[model samples]
Target: MTMTKIAFFDAHSYDRDSFEMWNKDFGFDIHYYKERLSMNSIELTKGKEIVCVFVNDEISAQVIDALVKNGVKLVALRCAGFNNVDLPEAKGKLRVVRVPAYSPHAVAEYAVTLMLSLNRKVYRSTQRTREGNFRLSGLLGFDMYGKTAGIVGMGRIAKVLVNILKGFGMNILAYDKFPDMKWAKENGVKMVDLPELYANSDVISLHCPLTHETLHMIDKDAIDMMKPGVMIINTGRGKLIRTEDLIQGLRSHKVGSAGLDVYEEEAKFFYEDHSDRMINDDHLALLLMMPNVIVTSHQAFFTREALQNIATTTLQNCKDFLDGKELVNEVMAK
Candidate 1:
């Protein structure tokens, strides 16, 4: 049997380690590339049966054309979100499969981590303590108990987060286009509209996929509807919230604090070290300067368990395609 050739782009040390560890079972001929998949890097896909990519890799229409020209049969996404992929372009040319659910707990827990860290000024406090300044003047936080938490999108990760937040005695208000009434009732979650969730929630955590209708969903208008000093947490796609609008909200104090695991224009900066360089993006620079905001480089799904699951599911996706089996996790253009 000929081993399937997979070109893994945007390869990190951890990614290589995890995938290589699991590739033994599938016996795939995997080639790793540190650079992200883009027009310039499209040549790497030549002669490969599949191209594996991550969240930050570019899978534009042009890239799709190049992949098809390169004889690539499959595009295996190691992550859940496929906003980076040009689904419409790849529809007839190539099959796209993704790890729909790697480890929901990893992301859900990270969202909670950001909430707690922001509320308690954990990051600030840790820095101050290290400097031998024990003054607790700015370290103020409210009890999570009895606070209203509005969860945008009750997907797998959101459901896990709901259970965790419920333990804190939080009133869960959820908003999903297709609300699962049965699940909401069983979980003690109140299904509300976006406006209601924005108005009532003391803390708002976003866990929705990015779509045309949902693009810039948390713009100035939405921010205006939110409760004063509402804490915002986004562990989902960054484009879901408009960065400039969010900066304005933070500046005006409409948003008390923000915890972001992703950024709309993070492809150039995130997942890479920029400590030696200056951040040219003014909006991102302003956001980083804000004490009330915490920006993470999309590391919510960085847990060992999640990485393992991603590798396993991603390889299985390729194997399924090669075997002419049903591609259960295959995503289509809508």
Candidate 2:
């Protein structure tokens, strides 16, 4: 049997550590590149059979074509999301697989953490205490119990989040194209329409994928339908909510608070230290200044367990493809 040569893009210290640790088992000829996968970076994959990418990499049609020209057979996404990849272009050109369910608990717990932190003013409290000013006047927070929490998706992560919210005595209102009636019946979760979820929920969290229909789903019109002073949380794709619309919502007090782990144009800002340089994104800068908003740099799935799962699953996907085995996690455009 011949060995598989893999080219990994968007390589970071943690990503390298995890992949290197797992690669010892398979012993494939792997090369890591710190640059993200794009049309310009296609030359790096010359003669490589598999190209591994992360969430921030650009896997557009041009990139896919370039990869095919470079003899790349498989595109292994280390993350669960394949929105960055052009599925239609790669459907017959090259195989694509992803780590669909790395650690739902990691993301679900982080979502709840963001909600609690935003609700209880944990960020403000930490800042105040650090400055030696212990004040509780502005830190008043309501109880999570009995509050209606709307979840926009009902996938693995959303189910985990629903279970966590249930533990807190919070009511669950979920919306999914294909409703899991059995699971909802057992968990006492009500499957509702988008408008109902918007008008009724006190706290709204987004877990849907970024598709043409779902893009900017939480726009100005959607925000208008939501309850006033509603808290919005997004750990899903950033493009789901229009940043300008969200900013306007914040100004009008339509959105009481936001806990975001991702941004629409986060590729340049996230996973890098830019403190020494000036922030060019005015919208993002304004969000950082807002007291009610909490922005994390897409770190919800950064736990050790999730990283391990991602690395193992990604490598196994490549191995399976090379061995002519079934690609269980393969993703294609419908």
For residues 128-232, write the lDDT of model 1, one tens digit per residue. 989999999989999999999999999999999999999999999999999999999999999999999999999999999999988999999999999999999
Q: For residues 1-334, what per-residue lDDT tens digits would candidate 2 score against the true structure?
A: 6678899998989989998998899889889999999887889999999999999999999999999999999999999999999999998999999999999999999999999999999999999999999979889899999999999999999999999999999999999988998999999999999999999999999998898989999999999999999999999999999999999999999999999999999998999999999999999999999999999999999899999999999999998998899999999999
TM-score for candidate 2: 0.99
Q: Tell me how candidate 1 scores on lDDT.
A: 0.95
Supply candidate 1's per-residue lDDT for 247: 88
After superposition, candidate 1 runs with Cα above 4 Å error: none
Candidate 2 pairs with clashing backbones = none
